[model samples]
Target: MKIDVKVPAVGESVTEATIGSWNKKNGEFVKRNEVLLLLETDKASVEVVAENDGVLAIQVEAGQVVKIGATVGILDTEGKASAVSSEAPKTAPVTASQPTQAPVTSSPASAHLSPAVQRIVTENNLNPSQIAGTGKDGRLTKGDVLAASTAAVAPTPAAAPAKTEAKSKAAPAPAIFAASGKLSKQGEKKIVPMTTIRKKIAERLVEAQNTAAILTTFNEIDMTKVNEIRNKYKDKFKEKYGISLGMMGIFTKAAVEALKAFPAVNAYISGAGAGTEIEYHNYYNIGIAVSTEKGLMVPVIKDADQMSLAEIEMAIRDYALKARDGKIGVDDLTGGTFSITNGGVFGSLMSTPILNPPQSAILGMHKVEDRAVVINGKIEVRPMMYVALSYDHRIIDGKESVSFLVKIKEGVEDPERLLFGV
Candidate 1:
């Protein structure tokens, strides 16, 4: 019997996905529930597992866009895996005085290599045994092979030093004219097709600009108290929960509290004019905008209001790790009532965040700077952070937006307020 392997429904809005790398090749035997390939959706990359233990028969090639429920591959459940042969190396009988020579045979590691890993190994004429494996059951991943290849090849110092000396001598020149080599590089241009994730991001950004009456409101919060609390409790928190205390947890708590106080900030406009409807959420599902190498992905922390500070930190950490590794799923990307993006990590002082459609507002956290301010008629230096809330003006009134931000500012400046749900 043959089993059909079809593209699963990744998300409610995502109708199609690009077939990413196939871990198993056609005619390769895969175990049931083993990851067979990756499906790259707009938001994240999902792992598609084998339906049964069988010989894989891939129907779609990598990088092809397939609609939901379309067949991607087939599994011949009744077929047996090909057996790999091993033969002893033939050598002349060794005399007692003769030193043993290394075996002139390829590493058996090739037997377990994936298509991507096999390509690299073959290209570089590398012995897979020399490289370390980081994947499951000591299997070599593509990244592991690439890293090993890079480390194995040392730069040619003989040519590099001469080029460096020439560049140093040319540094004194008033103007540097482009040589033929430089001109060649300048003229070099290559067009590459955008990945599915990048295309979807571009579309959504343009859609957000076109559909919403977007407005940004800004405020500054003193971080003196928040900093104190974290500094005081971070060690104990980590020891107790096995996760470090982080800024995202505090921000998530504040955002959830503020959303409760001003529910309008958590609502979105569904239609226009008489058909317009303001859909409000009773529970808080806050998204932490994570930037991965592929693109920006917002994985929601569901029912955030019910989670503790330590749980929020752990969840954020897990989301970031999964997003970085392209393991985040469709369910992780959807149903966000509000979002918080910290540009501070990237050293951004201030910026307006674009809305994630259907979610009316997004809170942007910026770098905290030490500045002098007057307190009780005395000049005091304190760490202050500039926060911005970008809201859909159609649904969230300016007054509501301002109040919502004020609540966030209050909760952050005095985190005890967030704990008490004030």
Candidate 2:
């Protein structure tokens, strides 16, 4: 019995994916639920698993574009394996008289070779068994085949020219030598095609720039009190929760309080004129902007205001790791009322964060630096961080935006306010 293995739908709006790599080779036995291939889509990379135990008969090649539900391979069921094995072609044993010459017929399975390897094999008319594989589990890699082809076609010593006369008339050894030092180094510039997430980010940034009256309000917070709390309880918190307590947890709590106090900043502009007053959300789903190798992805922690500090820290850590590994789901990256981005992690001093679309505002956190400040009319060194709030000016006035930032500053400076909800 032949079992068809098709590509499963990864997520909504994701219709196609490229075969990243195959974990198993054609004709190899695979177990049920074993990962067979890696599928790369616009948003994530997922493992394609075998549905049943059988020998894999791959129909598509790695790097080939396949649509959702497309057949990638066929599985030979238990009872049919013996029959399939019997049908395989019998080869004449190698001998001096036979010369071990290449066969005339090529297996249909050859059509499933990766493009890079396929091109080299077809151009050289090489047999699959002739070259040794070096990829995972001894599968033929692109580099392996290319190297094999190069060795086979290399010029022999007998074909070299015996002797040659130096030409005295050769044009003055061209002035090209003088320009060698001025040439640009290798890979000085590169133009890579944008990935799906990057393209989406570009579109969103442009939309935000064009649609909203964007404005940024800045304020600085003294980290003295916040650091004191963390230094006092970080060890206990980590031991109890199995996770480190970070500034994000403290900041998230402060942001939630500020959002509650300035309801208008948390609100979105739904309609125009009489129909549009302001739609305020009672719950806060804060978007935490995470930087990944592919690009920036914002995964929301739903109802963050209701979560404890430890819960918020764990959720952020989980989402960040998932986003970096390209395992975050569509639902994880959507639906947020506000966003927080920390450029300080990358050593940035300050930046005006762009708002995630539909969300009225975004908070930017910058690196902390020790600075002399007036304390009781006396100058003293204090750890301070500059915070910037970028908001839609149309919805939030300058006063409200400034006040909202000041509220966050106060809450962070005196974290006790977070406990009492002052």
lDDT (CA) per prediction: 0.81, 0.78
TM-score of each: 0.78, 0.72
lDDT of 1 by residue, 1-422 (tens): 99999999987888998887666656778899999888888777878998789988778767779999999888999987553221112224667543333332344444466534654654444567766688776777788887877765654555578668877886643223354334444453546578788898899889889888899999999999988988998899988988888888998999998998888888877767533788888999999999875778899999999998888999999999888667888899888989999999999999999999878999999999998989899999999999999999888889999999999999998887876788
Worst 10 residues of 1 by lDDT: 83-92
Task: After superposing candidate 2 on the true structure, give the runs of residues whose Cα lies further than 4 Å from its correct spot.
Answer: 1-3, 18-23, 58-66, 78-183, 186-190, 270-279
Query: What's the C-alpha lDDT at position 246 in model 2?
Result: 95
Q: Point to the candidate with the largest lDDT.
A: 1
Candidate 2 lDDT over 222-305, as tens digits, reads: 999988888999999999999888999889999999999998888887776423567889989999999875578889999998
